[model samples]
Target: MPKGGKHVGKIASKGTSSLSIPGPPSSKPPDVTPSVASVLDELKSVIKQTQEEKEVGEQTLTGINKTHEKVKNEPRVSLYFKQKLQNQYVNALQAAKRELVLLEQCLKKVDEVKVEIGEVQARAAPPSTRNIDDYRSKMHSGLGTMRRGMLMTVLQQYAVEQQVWKGKPGESPPPLCGCVPADEKYRCKPADQVAARVRTEDGEEQWILAEVFSYNSHNHRYCVDDIDEEGHNEQRRYHVSKRRIVPLPRFKADPLTNPEALFRHRQLVLALYPQTTCFYRAIIDSPPKEVAGEYSVLFEDTSYPEGYSPALDVPQRYVLPMRETKKK
Candidate 1:
């Protein structure tokens, strides 16, 4: 082997880093391998299917056994008839047994794959939060490349806006062109632009407007931007699941356009229930219905004076749909 090849092997065996030495200056980029996330996803899908098959096999066996038991208990049944029935049941039971064995093998294979993936993650993952930042950078680069023209225009405008806003002497933004890196799989999806309820650290709950942004396919989480009544707030971009947010009441009303007005309305609702955040349990109450484009919900705000009941009669535009949470 060449001298460089020997060094490469030594470093690789030591597992010092995931990076490999590149070829001389003219060499192409290294080939990418399948990500652990994709492999694990496939394995999980197969395991779920295998479990379903196992359940079916067990059910089949149970039904066959029940039929066989009933036939055996019939005192007037003929010997040949009973023998035929037993033979059929036996054949079915054997088939079910074979299926069960196959499913068990599939489960074993799934376990092995999971262990292998865990090992790969341990070996390849970085020690700090840098990996997440890198992932986000890649996603943005990919999007920029795919949307070169539009993204470039936006970038230019953003630069001019920054320069004008900063008013720094001789500190113009860098010039950009329409050559965004291509990101084939990562597509920007429209955010869920609706008002919802969220709790603050102090346990005080209030209604906030929010929009869905990009999604992280690897982590399977939503990049949500919580738009306060003042509009899009950069500080509120968080990775949140659907369960943490509750839909707002949509009494007979139009969507509020002004941020200040929206904020004030939100405050009014909070004032009605100052003691606690909004709560909608799955078992407590049925979902509100839209009647003539309006929704009627009972506000169980404890902040109200004793024996004071507040009901929400509003338009459907005020209520946001439930966000779907994926099974991890």
Candidate 2:
């Protein structure tokens, strides 16, 4: 079983409830409270003691074997005497085995306790500074005319980034672009999705999930959040041309186990002129032919463009529902 297997399972079974997008995973290091530290220290000591006990048990078994060998090899030993000696050796060996088994069980329990303590620490640590402020603003902003779906989706992505579900913050906010207010470029418009070029082990580059931190409005250069395919957050930023960054599809945050699941089939609006009111009517069954990981979707529109087909290739973050962007 996984460390958080039960928790993940519960989230999966509950359907999409508040628990699904609860607080994002914390990017800040876990706080080691004094009590937790003390508990860890105690566990370490217990492990040491159990190890010692196991060694002693092994020694006892060795001694029993030697004694039994000597008694069995003795010259002219009577059958009754040999039988009695063998019984004594068997009893000693069994006792030693029982002692070793008990010590092993204790060691296993100690590991379990350690993992539980770490989990508690992770759960207790607060979200990063940005998430706290963002969440606070959302709360205080009058609940009047709330776009519950949009708000939820925004929060989920915020949590994922802050908690670092798929990527980590760049080191020092990528050198600020003097031409464009670094702050302005960092802002991801509701219609835009952040993307970056990632170089793989075989010298191949792929565009993957990214968070834009800085952009040079003057030179068309951008500093984007760089991540590896395995989802481990990288500290370096990818500097690239403006054209390299692709927009993300619009999506609602679903309580899914991993980043991939969260990005899978979702309700999205076609990036067509927002005026036409184009939306993906159903979750796509699969991606377009020969294009892995890209969603192939059909749009529902009251009014259609002259050259438009019912199908298009859209990534999860790129799809925006018409309703969310109407007032923008």
Runs with alpha carbons beyond 4 Å of true place in candidate 1: 1-188, 194-207, 229-235, 242-291, 305-308, 320-328
Alpha carbon lDDT at 286, candidate 2: 43
For residues 176-196, write the lDDT of model 2, one tens digit per residue. Answer: 110011233444442233544
Candidate 1 C-alpha error for residue 283, in Å: 11
Q: How many residue pairs clash in each candidate?
A: 13, 10
Expressed as tens digits, the lDDT of each residue in 22-136 for candidate 1 is 1112332343235534444554554455455546555656666676677777778778667766776776566556545544444434433444444444445443212223323
Give candidate 2's TM-score. 0.27
Most lDDT-accurate candidate: 2
Tell me the TM-score of each prediction against the true structure: 0.26, 0.27
